[model samples]
Target: MTLTDVLDDWPLWGISKQPISANQISILEGGLTNRCYQLSLESGEYIIRISAANTAELGIDRNVEKTIHQLVSSLNFTSAIRYCDDENRYLIRDYIEGEVLSDNVEDMSHNTLSYMVEQLKALHQVPVEIDLPVVNISEKAEAYWQMLATQQPNNEILKMKPLMQVAMSEPPAGDFCLCHLDPVLANWLYTAEGLQLLDWEYAGLAHPLWDLAALFQGIKHSFQQLEKKSKKNSHSEIEQNLENKILTLYGVSDLVAWRRACMQMEYLSSLWYQAQAKKDSY
Candidate 1:
């Protein structure tokens, strides 16, 4: 269906208007859960994102997303929501013109990791009350394991059960902040000024270190090349550099607490991927 047809029934516009004519470019083809389109317009491009595979069935709350977007926008950490159809879960956003950090971080020179950490720090600094319903780490893991039980008998879920146990046993020992729970490379755009975050579907109130750990896990393999290309730096040294940058930017004085948070996030990563895999199959 055309964008106009899909959004034709939206009540927010009240009066129906013709959809803006633009060349529709499909930028993200690999995302399993959402159908995202980049609409190139005469004035500027815009993004049109729609949930896939019945996100509502998988615990996605469009109303909660709307609230989170407003909260995050107030702090300037994410793009402002231009228009939303809460019932249909269609979103229109002003497209950001910048390179995705995946491409920009290829070489990783001159404190690029540090810059990202600082950017994340600025995002976490935004304090706001999150009334949104967010899936906790244990719930996320349980969903994955449940899917595994129904799909294939994979021992990986059994192996991860204990890890999840350890992670959820200890509650967050530090202050909670507004966190961008998902840190995919596509979610970040690097501009001349700084990094801009996109995609608020997974945002909520959580420990700040969650985002940091998620980013590290996502980019671990990709950043290896950056580590090799760096002058006089070992892989461990590069990893440490990234960690220090995150700590410094977030002003984290409790290293032990932060480390525990990162560990928890790593296990959550396993569950997230597992969940995505199940969603793709069925």
Candidate 2:
């Protein structure tokens, strides 16, 4: 539950038989649902992630995550999970030394782009051998809204309520697959083991397009932020070409539905951030 607790209980973590000093642990940037620490053990380095409280209330199912993660790990699409807690309190994985795909996402070589898309394609095809839960877009949005409502939401948050409703009104994508649901650029890494998606809390059975929508939107956001910082005009055409290539490569012909899913993904992302901001207890 706390850094002190983790350090004090090191032997129980399935890391090493030997004890480790406090100086061996250092904080690392983490995702929305957990606090991360990199432990430099004598054998090697590892990442110990302490999950946030009330994960179930935030639409995260640790059991489902574990099952799906094991499947992905087998395919070499994610970091090797060295030790997973029985109570879902913490996870220890080998520390991956590599770069995220965020900066080069907008201008990756053609072969690199294809390889990335191929990885995503392969993930979507993973068999639903285990009984995994399907994602409920509407319910998830409402759950986030309820949490946010208690926080004295501001004007921006208030306005998102309606926009979220609008996004929810659209029909769901026709197909389902084992989707990562959060394939944003930062989650992707090019480690020696190869490309891997680090975060697994949001993974579940969802539309194939949900991952795509998240991916493209992530690229657009990264480029826009960079453009603003550099004081350059935003290049909408680059975004268009990227989308076109993905559409053609992934065989997604329904532009209307794809665009709709992208919009809904944006609103859903906004709601999750506001809700998490108010409730995150690390």
Candidate 3:
């Protein structure tokens, strides 16, 4: 179905609707599992997100996502959901006017870092009334591996299975709290109001450290991209400096956090690639 067809039946939540023209709708990038677009109207700008098919295979529960959006919007940490359609798997939200953060650590100022840490701490403290799924990295990875094997056996995935097992054997110690499983830089926006986190589809109850680890992995991935483009070893140094800064900000020792981050990074990357392969096969 076309976007217009979807919007024709959208519950606008009392907002006045204008003639939505092609010029007024622009596709937004960065989402891997959803189609995002910015819709401009005489009333205001908004974001319409359409979930991709078969996302359930990746452990995304749209019902859980709706609950998360409501909770975070109430806390003013995310954009307010103007309307949601559970059956259609689409939602309209107030468009946040701000700069979407870059993954580069150098681009992140000390103030931004502090703000990020504060927001994350607050997110972890929110009271969750509904029972959210726990993110078990090892089990998730193994599940993905098995799924991928059915399509076409991957030797690399098989080899990584043993390592994933070893990594999970000595799991990090931390309280299970609400976490944004995918906090990569693109999901963060710095606005006049404050720092707002977008895309809560992957949000769930897990080790608070997992959030930190996801952030670290995101920064490291950004540096890796830079290293590939510039062929400079300086990117590695910058990544290490950022890691040290993160460790200091969180008051965690380098040993425990880094190890946990590495393990989570591996599991996340493996699952991500397998998911991509699965999607492509479909």
Assess each prediction's global lDDT (C-alpha) against the native.
Answer: 0.66, 0.79, 0.76
Tell how far residue 9 is off in model 3, in angstroms: 1.3
Model 1, clash count?
A: 0
- Per-residue CA lDDT of model 1 for 78-128, tens digit only, reads 676767764655777777778877675556654666677777777778756
lDDT of 3 by residue, 179-260 (tens): 8877888889988988899999878888777787788788678778777888877766667777777767877764775677
Q: Candidate 2, after superposition: displacement of residue 26 in Å?
A: 2.0
The alpha-carbon lDDT assigned to residue 271 of candidate 3 equals: 71
Cα misplacement distance, residue 41 of candidate 2 (Å)? 1.4
> Is candidate 1 or 3 superior in lDDT?
3
**For candidate 2, lDDT tens digit of each residue in 214-249?**
888887787788778878866666777888887888
Clashing pairs in 2: none
Candidate 3: stretches off by over 4 Å: 11-13, 103-105, 159-170
- Residue 72 lDDT, candidate 1, scale 0-100: 70
The true-versus-predicted C-alpha distance at residue 39 of model 3, in Å, is: 0.7
Query: Which runs of model 2 end up more than 4 angstroms from their true locations?
Result: 103-107, 153-163, 166-173
